[model samples]
Target: MSTSASQQADLDPASFRAIADLAYRESGLTLVQEKSSMIQSRLRHRLRDLGLADFAAYCSLVQSDAGQGERRNLISALTTNVSHFFRESHHFDVLRAELDRHLPKLRAGGQLRIWSAGCSNGQEALSAAMTLLDHVPDVARLDLRILATDIDPEVVQFARKATYPERLVRGISPDMLKKYFDQTTEAGHEPSYIAKPVLTDVIRVNELNLLSPWPMRKRFDIIFCRNVVIYFDQRTQEKLWPSFLNALAPDGVLLLGHSERIAEPERYGFTCTGPTTYRPCHALKSTARPEKQKQSEG
Candidate 1:
């Protein structure tokens, strides 16, 4: 084959289309032609790991009925996992306030749940745990837990390990880092930190696809779905709004990435309570306007 033909065959147009369709069907992720080169680069390792020479064969395997298992790995490779401790610091502030508000009910034997939806590598959930501790040092005694979930099983496993190298944890303050992380490094390796039981003890990690049906019967007090839905197309995103709204307690808050917005959240039973933050207003499914930010009830 000519060099151009070989290059085309490597990530053939058909293969690209197949990969994109498979990703959307399996995980509600959107792919466009402009990103084909980047997708090709990302999946090249998968091809090699599977002992394949090019995208065509890899695509064939992943798109077939027998390709069911590989679909997970394919989505894992395609998904982005950039995250840090206490990203979008304001959300942590909101968490502090919410935890404080719920302290009374929690002390009275009520449960408080927070979910780090699309939680990548555990930082977001850990950060929430830290925030909860900061707000109420005795929080572990209460029925409180942070569910950290991601579609990528590998990343979920990484989160469950609760270990982080220096670079991935840059957002953590020195004092909090010292208090919450144990230096778990060996003599020859670069310095790394593992979340102490004080943090991890309150967190549960699981692999979950946001597009799939959620198994939790209990609604959450806070849902941090930041920087996640941006990967989906408008229809996919809109479909997610109702699920998130239903998953949240009536007065519960939902936070999104700075760039992500539910096109008029009130339409989907949420009121913009803060910057890219929302609270369920289920009563307003039809004619409710965005209400003024209401404080969480104590």
Candidate 2:
């Protein structure tokens, strides 16, 4: 169908706003007026699946109390989850370097925690696991684990399954692929690879909504929330900076998308150490600010 036909025949402004508001409230995803056409395009599948005639009916259902269960479907349709193994290579290099420095401490029975917030389809978390395994072969035996989470439960389940098609595994080196994944071909399906127990054993997949309160009790030594914040507005993004800071252990590292940066690092008690990489100010004693100063600076 043509774009004009879809927009004019399906959704009106009121219905689009309703969806945008729901998305923002539930998932912190900012769907502004400019996204009206895109929103209509994305939600067409839902309308077809439900046998709805237009966006007005879809909106009525989603906004009513009876449509609570459909909200998840709405989010799944609207949110994009384009990711791949080693999507951002430099972050892995930095992780490897950090692990090298922390090797002595890890060997001394110290605990290490890494959180892959907004971990879509488990690539980011799995990449971290691969890096750790490459640097510290004994990571599995140590008190180390990667917490991979995404708001989409379906993707979380997919991550737990640890299987990917040949296309998705293209960037992974053959040596690493051979070491970490096992080839499998179903009777009628295309050839696929599944992560071996050695790799999957050290990672935990969870379905979590970042907008909601975090349930974990421990702080993370490293956090990978790359590219996920782009969907949120600046205000929503600002609110998350403090939460991420508080969740990170002192001296912990926070890795962001290539285009994402902490707007005011000093205010959040973070200092840029590398491109899209930050460390808590407390980690740098010399640069630590007084509580009063920090408050005033923010």
Best by lDDT: 1
TM-score of each: 0.91, 0.91
lDDT of 1 by residue, 98-122 (tens): 8877888999999999999999899
Residue 298 alpha-carbon offset, candidate 1, angstroms: 32
**Worst ten-residue run, lDDT, model 1?**
289-298
Give the clashing residue pairs of candidate 2, or none: none
Clashing pairs in 1: none
Count backbone overlaps in model 2.
Answer: 0
Question: Cα RMSDs of all predictions?
Answer: 4.5, 4.8
lDDT of each: 0.86, 0.85
